[model samples]
Target: MSNRDYSLSDVVALLVESGDNASTFYRYSDDVPMPSVEVLSEIVEDLRTVLFPGYYGPSEITPDTMPYYIGSTLDRVERHLADQINRGYCFVCDKNKVDRCQDCETRSRNMARAFITKLPEIRELLLSDVEAAYDGDPAAKTHGETIFCYPSIRTMTNHRIAHELYKLGVDIIPRIIGEMAHSDTGIDIHPGATIGRSFFMDHGTGTVIGETCVIGDNVRVYQGVTLGAKSFPKGDDERLIKGLPRHPLVEDDVIIYAGATILGRVTIGKGAVIGGNVWITRDVPAGAQIVQSRAMQQSFSDGGGI
Candidate 1:
């Protein structure tokens, strides 16, 4: 070992130059690939436009050709979704077994088929989300704007779709969907979080709903709200606990305002309203309104007192 032909710095430089950064924009490496958000977003746009017709994307949807248009759009979405899913599947597959792709192909088909089968239900959930946003926000004139512009709607839509995939046991795909929306909207909703019907996240930004958080129906949350873990549970080896219910359980009709961080297994009771910037670790009674202040104000009104 007199002298190395290539120094450590020289090897590092070569590695960086050969990495993903050196690739042409047209080509992407699966080893460190960009989530096909641009492609998937277009798919979602087309799919949503088809699903809700005049209420979501294109306004030129005609009654006579509505069914035809929807069918065509669904077909295209299915193809596009399946293609990307297959790419993801193969990417994550054993690099050495790339030639044995039967399993990957089957997985992709099954995943795509399951997602396609759940389309009607997904649309129903998204329909409620649109209604919730419209009713919650005064500026939302119509569902069209909510679908197009509202960050909450986008985040929830991605969560709902991703949750479905997660339930189907398609790993990574769900995160990709959630992260895609997160990149665009600045809202972080884990697909594993359980959120019930008629939920509304008002002016949602910087909101983080951790995995294992259970949110009930008619729950409303505002911007900068976080339902996170009180403390990380570690194993005998001292590794942080996994798959535990670490976040808050917000019951039906609970309203949490901006900048509120409700941690632990605490239950914000049914019809409770949590005000802005408050950090809560304990359980709350039903129909209680906890506002921010030195006084710890309680309005005694369920949810928003509405």
Candidate 2:
């Protein structure tokens, strides 16, 4: 082990050899190109430009020039998105040999076009989210401020775009897109989560919305709120089951305050108010208010009983 006895060539050869120990971490294929985080990040930015024209990408957009700008941006987005989708398809095919896709190019193009078709609807939903943020927060001065300054809108925009790709069957790209937003905003929303319009998250930091969560319209949540699973169901083989409804189902007009965690497939009924710093696992009735008992006692002691 002395420095004089060490051979650099031997060390390099030893590391380059793909033995059983090294096989798990290596991909030996060169036929399919891997997806690039840098390119996908650019694609997400271009899409955001198309989704909100005046805010991102190009700044000066007039009614006469908007169509040209949108068309050019969408064209670029579709091309890049198709390449990433094809990479995702090739990756899946390399992993699972049984159900290999023959024509990833055509499939990727079709999926990308289908996702593009969903842009108008996605923009409508995002506008509702912007309106929700403006109406729900007293500190918000204008809708433009929410669109430009709020992390919730940025996170939701990424979620909505990624959700469409998820539905269109573009596999790894959607999760990458979601993770990009998560890395940027500290709000983790799974692509598989079904969230309705007018969703607003105020001070949305450290919030985790698990897959299989179904949230209805006009739902407002604060920072440090978690909508997660209570337990994992195991089969006879002792492996955890996949794709089961494990997360909570939140109904319309629900307001979850900061530092609250709702677990399991329980329902938070319509018009229910979940107070701050509470943990809920069971279903709350419609119009019910759930809070900490100590907070309730303190409220009553202060002559502010509910």
Candidate 3:
């Protein structure tokens, strides 16, 4: 075979090798399915349409037709989400080699129903988020524009749905949902993070909110902001520990500028302003403004040597 081509035996060998490697890098099991990224993406779109009626929803939806569209959209969301959630449950069970996963479908249905019920609450939070985005940005033309055009809204919409699933204790699917938005919007918000009302990300890109982050209400963060962990504890076997609160606890009304990395379990107090490119590891008191230090300039007389 040439360098650009492969023989039949070689292709079969490559496929067999990849199948073997799946046990290490991926999940694989017979009779059990994994969560489909395409299905999850569809679910997100349906939920978005249901949440923001008349925006991405049916064109004929009006005061009388709203209920019909909402009901149908929610039914589709529940069906698709329940299937994916069941697959997520089965994926975990298969990984742990648990033989009893017969109840996964039931649990998934219940969780999906619960999540569907919370759509109104999620919509309310998103509305407030839209208002905050409009209020925070000077260039915003209207609240509707912010809702339809802002990347922050897109990120938060995905986050809110994923967070609801996370809170319901569903495995694998929440993270996948969060990543879908991250891939599209360049905002990396973990589903495990808890964000409050009126949260806004202005010019949001290169923003990394870690898994354990707890952000408060009315907080606005600019682009390239990282609310991340400083370090993670390791086990005696040299495995990194999980579930510790490592990311920052940002309180209400705090503003973190671009490229500011606030690490550890430190609390960013209410009303504090973190300047751009600042590396913060300690707790900040309320109303504090952290900025880069002043630089000193030295004038040289000699052109030949230092």
Whole-model lDDT values for every prediction: 0.79, 0.90, 0.88
Better of 2 and 3 by lDDT: 2
RMSD of each: 6.1, 4.0, 6.0
Model 3, 152-230: lDDT tens digits are 9999999999999999999999999999989989999999999999999998999999999999999999999999999
Stretches of candidate 3 exceeding 4 Å from the true structure: 1-6, 14-22, 295-306
lDDT of 3: 0.88
TM-score of each: 0.81, 0.91, 0.91
User: What tens digits encode model 2's per-residue C-alpha lDDT throughout 108-187?
Assistant: 99999999999999999999999999999999999999999999999999999999998887879989999998999999
Give the per-residue lDDT of model 1 (tens digit) for 123-215. Answer: 888888788888988989987788878888778878888898878877567888888888878899898999988788888889999988999
| Candidate 2 wrongly placed segments (more than 4 Å) | 1-19, 294-306
1 or 3: which has the higher TM-score?
3
Please name the candidate that would achieve the greatest lDDT relative to the true structure. 2
Best-to-worst ranking by lDDT: 2, 3, 1
Q: Which stretches of candidate 1 lie over 4 Å from their true place?
A: 1-35, 55-57, 95-102, 297-306
Sliding window of 10 residues with minimal summed lDDT for model 3: 297-306
What TM value does model 2 have?
Answer: 0.91
